[model samples]
Target chain A: MDIQFEPLQKRRLDQAKWAYTTRRINRDQNFQLLGGTLIPKAGDLVLARVDELGQHQRLELVTSRRASLYEEDEIVVVYGNRYAPDQFEGIVPDHLEPCRLVAAGGVAARLLNRHDRVKTATRITPLGLLADDKGYRINLSSARLPKAEQIDHKPLVLVVAGTSMNSGKTTACANLVKGFVRQGIKVAAAKFTGTGAGADYRALVDAGADPVFDFVDAGYVSTYRVHRDVLLDIVMTLGAEMSSNKPDVIVIEVADGLLQRETARLFAIPEFTDWIDGVVFAANDALGAQAGVSWLSARQLPVFAITGVLTASPLAQREAHDICGLPVYHTNALAQKSVSSYVYSCLKFRSQKQSISNPVREEVG
Target chain B: MTDTPQPGKIHCRTIEGMSQTNYFVYIPSETTDQRRIFYTVHGISRNAEEHIHGFIAQAERYGAIIVAPLFLKENFPHYQQLGSSATLERADMAFDHVLQDVHEWLKIPPSPMHMFGFSGGGQFLHRYAMFNPKRVARMVLAAPGWYTFPDPGQKYPYGIKSTLEWPNLKFSMEKFLQIPTLVLTGDEDDQRDKDLNKTRKIDCFQGLNRIERAERWTAAARALGRAYNIPTDFKMESIPNASHAYESYLAHPPFAQQIFDFLFEAQN
Candidate 1:
């Protein structure tokens, strides 16, 4: 199969005055452009001066290669104001100034025009540009978002909840995300219940949430005492964000106890239930966690795993498996490579089964 | 300054990257250098630091390292009922992270680790012990709220409550019976009395007196141990003239001495 790289109309720049400069390509510092140039072809490398070294000295570089003809160790060019014939090492530092370009190789070369510039725009939020001149704007959000008319290939989502406030739900969700991510599967993570805190989202990201969102991003101070309708809206918004990522799996974390008015209401919502593929119950110990699983089972929710605070011990793991009949995992157990790998295998198997069972079909004629 | 035994100062470190502000105190042991570590969970108030100070004074007498991790109200929004994921996650992470910290500080294998929860703290400790039974050498649960059996339909002196309705009830009794447990409560504890008063308060569905709950827990543990044939040593006791609060019990020489003796007793 031929690979093609389209100029992603996005650019990122870093400004540093004098001292040492770091050269980077595609956000990686390992690759550097050595100073040299013959002809700039469709996919040919070009170095443009991006920053001032001292007075007359300018730093320049071509960091990316066109989709075609780009080899791992292919050499590019770095142009500086003061060029040394024998020494190109004086310019590229540990950090590089940001620049933008369109590369064409093979099929990409045919699609490129010599004067074609990647159409880049400053991301303007309602609050205006985040930075004026110095900070480079990088579009972190993916552009290949799933469309309403397009068939949904995204993995089914599963959100878990506890009975009260400290029942291990977030840990379970994070562990599940980590497990899925380790399987080379992309996963989106979000907290569907409770007031938003940045820590859980960051933890989820660290655990391999390709994209993570929470109630805080939705402009709520906290989910405590919020109306059922408002909570559902926030959850739906998160689901939409996850869907946009087109992840192989989505893990939603519900805060507080399952019996809480907010949690119960969120779980009972038809829209939320339909999106969920399975539920995982996290509790402090084996007993309460089992009770939580039973409650969900009674409501006919397909619970895939029963994990909680106790997973740190093998006994708890065995007991959970024996009693709940669901695979058990401990959040702290992720620190162990063997346990993490095992969890990944289980989740991967489930994800593959889900895909096979529900094949994505194109729009009917 | 005089070398007069300085009441150990309470130290609090705010965990970075958590939504609610949670704190844990390091109580240096006053006795032996063997370095015994215990984590105390606070009751309804979720004030772990206070409990740490209280336990530190007691711990100092025994020369055991005491760590009181305060599960703050802010951290656990639902003060009365703490089954929420936020609360569970916070507790799990706090304990998980704190264990690492404790291991680093003690500079040894994480052994002789135990958890003590009084009242609301007892609820948390029981759950913590239940979840991580292997790591814990002993669990001292003083007036815990809930106890479960294999069958949810069984009735007890406290009341006939169904364990099925309680959250996190998925743990097996066979596993629960394996851990060595010490259940204690005050004879005159109003909570136990209240629990006895409310007949429908089974499975933590309603509140009960601390004494009645303790007795029921003892019976349940004994019954569970017998059923599982787990040879578990579950002890239940009521300190005379002491209410639900450990302050009174701790103040009385007989009660205090008994507790200290029980806690320090060798576990083979």
Candidate 2:
């Protein structure tokens, strides 16, 4: 039930607003990392009482505050669960008593599993729900997402997928964005799927992405476990957002390794490739790069280049170049202006050729 | 008249103690009357020459001598050994012996030196500062991958808790809190590549990514200082418009000025 509510603590008065201001967030309650029709659907906003403090040393109220400052009993409105590879125990089971701040980036969760590195997680106790101004429990599904317009043209979409978190996908995407921008092309970027955090989005902007967006902007705290269809909707919605900017090329980063449940399912779909013109696979080593490129090739996905953590070491780069069949772009070369130029031209030519042969004049001004 | 140096005057010498490492020393050519010595630590790339030279302009500006020693991988191996975290190698002993040599070579009688390290060097300096807080005037750590946090929850590379149980290598939380520390990171330096130390031991205490680890260490240090009722001279700074590159801050005028000012401005 949604109703007029009050915050017991001034610190949390701004926590919900922080999905905009802060890079990492830990909200009140009702956050889910999984992608399903679970608790707190889109548009369903509720009042959650902050119960306890656990693993999270810091908390974001409005402008990103600390959790250590909050008292025992305080009510704060927060978004759903956060699913991060580094520190997640499980998703929230019910609007229950011991809900965890699954992501320090600010998503709440039930928390099923976690790594040894995760000390005691920050736990928040949720009080009974309250009705909103309209008295209708805010459902995320009811949130208004812009419908994709039937467009005639498809922009050259370059998707950056990685073998796992910390595999250099963000940097690769940033490098590509910066490279393309220096080549006098309008570049835009969006992280299609990942836990909620502003790190990558900000990095992309610094790397010359004109306008950048992420799953959080698509109205989800994180896309870690969001259902397949909902995740797809988020992708299309993100495409619409980037397309609105009319970028010459759009680079999207798909979070996590290819073996990740969400990433694998997303990649398995044929429609997913329809949106992507080409893909760059980033891996931690040459072995993974070759395996990823070959895997994508077998699946009919276009992997034009291999890059990532391996590029930092010359030995790794040489090995990747030799084994991966596809062109291996080293870190320095990947960050140069020519790589983006080459990528842009290749994508442009492919799309133009597709439009010409298909008889359907797809969108591209 | 300022004690400015003639352009490109670096004195190279070998550490007889280690018998393998080469170091570069830059003293203001005009006068060797140095108020303090500022040592620059190199990262994993082992490019000590550039790292040592990066502080040249400021070294002259503040009349401080600069020393950058090269640690060959053949001797130091991975970050574990070079950063002085591993027990069997005792990088601490090497550094102690090496600093003695440096002081003997400089002929200034060993003095408290300002310690500056970038990337992997940051890892080494923090650990060095943790155990040898007495020898350092101020510790400037710029973007270390992992931190030996001031906590007993984890051991060594993860926290200051000693794993080797060396009798002399023990760290006092009180003494560590007193060491003035300045942590620098570009707001854009959020690189979490595989090269970043991600061992379970480190990942547990230091958080996942570099930014997380940096902020966490700062927060933890402040918190520890508060618990012990000690003063925490720790600050985590973020430079804008820069990523995870040495040149972004080391050579950039604005950042170099900020870093140099932190070390020299407060000097009497």
Query: Model 2, stretches more than 4 Å misplaced?
Result: A1-55, A59-82, A128-131, A139-144, A149-152, A353-365, B1-268
For model 1, what is the C-alpha lDDT against the true structure?
A: 0.50
**DockQ, every prediction:** 0.02, 0.01
Question: Candidate 2, chain A: TM-score?
Answer: 0.80
Compared with the true structure, what per-residue lDDT tens digits does model 1 show for residues B172-221? 34455566678777766755334233445452423356665566565555
TM-score of each: 0.37, 0.50
Off by over 4 Å in 1: A1-365, B1-8, B29-32, B78-82, B85-90, B148-172, B190-208
Choose the strongest candidate by DockQ: 1
Candidate 2 lDDT tens digits, B1-268:
1132343488776655443666777877555545578887888887788976777777777777787877777767644334444554555565666577767766665658787888888888888777777778787888888777664424455654345543223565566777888999878878777678777766654567788888877876765553333567899888886677887775456776777788766685
Could you give the DockQ of candidate 2? 0.01
- CA displacement after TM-score superposition, residue B133 of candidate 2 (Å): 63
Report lDDT per candidate. Answer: 0.50, 0.66
